[model samples]
Target: MKIQEIREIIKLIDQSTLTEFSYESEGTKIKLKKYESSSIFTNGQQLDSSSVVEQPKVAEVKAALAPVVQQQKEVVTETVEVAEESKLHKIKSPMVGTFYQSSSPSEAAYVQVGSKVTGESIVCIVEAMKLFNEIEAEIDGEIVEILVKDGQLVEYGQPLFLVREN
Candidate 1:
């Protein structure tokens, strides 16, 4: 399924009162669950409904019912420095797909470290099922780091870049 279709499902679930929702179609299964925060008050009092806050977690989307191939690859660890600025932000993936740094293989990357961007700027593309979906920064900032490499497989809500607010 396309990212747009998955987004629509998420939107519908957000508008409903259901705590859990799942959909299966054409060998793909998507499930969404809402997590409500629980807090304890002073004097050992129970928390009331007014204190509850509900947050919808990212919907998990799986490709095929049957899983087959597995490949083993080398692993490496790298340390990244995070900005001390409180306005630092992350641009997260809206769907699971293969991340591309540029529109095509031979072109320069859309954004790199120190690149300034606006909320509507297209930072990268996540290609799923042969459909390339452009991902926006969504926040005005200067790109501090690129989180994903070219052709990397990313999951829903995965951070693609670290940006410091302008």
Candidate 2:
């Protein structure tokens, strides 16, 4: 809100490896950004605006550029623009080892194709060593496909089910 506040924010941002920082209160917003010389280079020289600039104009530009910069970032990772292979919601393993579809070998599988799952449903089990740890779904969706079968070895963070949104 004041010069002292903005100074404190800048100091806090500088203490970390953060390249950008922002704050908003009562219609007032402030941002501190680290501009790398290599990125903003004109020919071979760097553009340095270290001299004292007015607070209002600086805040206005920061507020304006923040959204534009973030939009540019989102443009690259946007799901529609990404290849189809990248859009699959990868249901990954939380731990490494064997993947089991049921609690026991003879029991029915926890989930199968077209199975609907909520956030709390136990999707599968990952046996790390002797302990069989039950893995649960973190989202609500319909199971599209089972990526792995019972008794198969799976790595941590591997997709077990392809859950299509309901």
Q: Which candidate is the best by lDDT?
A: 1
lDDT of 2 by residue, 1-166 (tens): 4566466557545544457777654456766787644334567966654532323434554554465456556765664545654654657899889999999988999999888899899999999979999998888888878999888999877888877765
Query: Cα-based RMSD of the predictions, in order?
Result: 21.7, 14.7
Backbone clashes, candidate 2: 1
Best by TM-score: 1
Cα TM-score per model:
0.49, 0.48
Scored against the true structure, residue 50 in model 1 reaches a CA lDDT of 60
Off by over 4 Å in 2: 1-86
lDDT, candidate 1, 57-131, per-residue tens: 443222221121111111111112222533469899999999999999999999999999999999999999999
